[model samples]
Target: MSELKTIDARNTFCPGPLMELITYMKQASVGDTLELLSTDEGSAGDVPEWINKVGHDLISNEKIDGVWHVKVRKAK
Candidate 1:
């Protein structure tokens, strides 16, 4: 069974949140879902683009209460 991991990157700026997600993603198993929490508005776009570029599955991308919640599943 795949697991869901939440990476809280709130209060960080662009690339910070994305980098944190990448670091965790490298250690995650295939099919595991990663939910990234970021206060940076740019992450909502940056993360999804990276996910697509790297061939991962983007489960959801939304903003709640000024925070961007980007969920992705490891595909490799």
Candidate 2:
């Protein structure tokens, strides 16, 4: 099973959640996973795009209880 790390960016706004994920990714080892929770709609797509652009794996991007849950795996 993949590890799940949740980054709470609710009410923070766009790019905030994404930036948090990026920061955490820098310290994570390859194969580690992060589950990002954000209220910012921009993260629905932006997060995954960042994962791809930076060579990470997006496990999923789903809505759970009105929050966007972005699942990512460290690929590099």
Candidate 3:
């Protein structure tokens, strides 16, 4: 499996995590995956929705305890 760059936004809010993800996206390659760790429940829906809107690939997601582990691939 390919190792992904991770951002731990467990204490952040909805748009915070998404913004960080987008900022990081700028430096990532087309196929590179970003693993976002957030505690905001809204992120489960918000991130994926934004990912689709921005043309990224939502590869997978999981919930561990209370944190959301989301994997997004940079497409553009």
Candidate 4:
């Protein structure tokens, strides 16, 4: 069974949150799920863009209480 991991990148800006997600993604197994939490508004769009560019599965992307939650599944 695939596992879900949370990567908190709250309070950080643009590339910071995206970079953190990429780092965790590298170490994640195929089919694993990663949920990224970020206070940066750009992450709502940026994270999903990156996920698509890299050929990953985007489970969901939403904002709650001013925080962005982007969920991705490792597809490669």
Candidate 5:
């Protein structure tokens, strides 16, 4: 199993969480899985859009206890 890079952006809003994800994604290797935790409602949509725009794969997105847990695989 591959290790997952975790980005805890809880309590952060919008671009903050998205920017953090992008920053980490840049450092992550291709095929690496990333887990993002965000409390921002916009991230539910923004993150996925950015992921697709950047050609990453979104594995899962679920909200648990008001936190959005998004898993993504780096494609490029």
Candidate 6:
């Protein structure tokens, strides 16, 4: 199974979670999956859009316990 890194951005605002995702992506190898948790409502939409813009793949996005869980795979 591939490694999955989790980035906890809960309670953080917009751009914060997005920035964290970008930073982690830089440190992650291609095909690696990342899980970003955030409480910001914008993240649900923002994360996926950013992933697509940067050539990454958004595996899933869901909300649990009022937190947004976004899964992304490094495509490049």
Top model number, TM-score: 1
Model 1, range 5-73, lDDT digits (tens) per residue?
999999976559999999999999999999999998788888899999999999999999998899999
Candidate 3 residue-pair clash tally: 0
lDDT of 3 at 59: 90
| Residue-by-residue lDDT tens digits, candidate 4, 1-76 | 7999999999866558999999999999999999999998778887898899989999999889998889999999
Candidate 1 is scored at a TM of 0.94
TM-score each candidate. Answer: 0.94, 0.87, 0.88, 0.93, 0.91, 0.92
Worst ten in a row by lDDT for model 5: 9-18
Which segments of candidate 4 are over 4 A away from where they belong? none
- Point out where model 1 deviates above 4 Å: none
**Ranking according to TM-score, highest score first:** 1, 4, 6, 5, 3, 2
Off by over 4 Å in 6: none
In candidate 3, stretches whose alpha carbon ends up further than 4 angstroms from where it belongs are 1-3
Per-residue lDDT of candidate 6, residues 1-76 (tens digit): 4689999998876559999999999999999999999998888887899998888999999999899999999988
- Candidate 2 structure lDDT: 0.84
3 against 5, candidate with superior lDDT: 5
Candidate 4 TM-score to native: 0.93
Which pairs clash in the backbone of model 3? none
**lDDT, candidate 2, 1-76, per-residue tens:** 4466777888785568999888888887788888888988888988888888888888889998889988899988
- Model 1: weakest 10-residue lDDT segment is 7-16
Which of 1 and 2 is the better model by lDDT? 1
Clashing pairs in 2: none
What's each prediction's clash count?
A: 0, 0, 0, 0, 0, 0
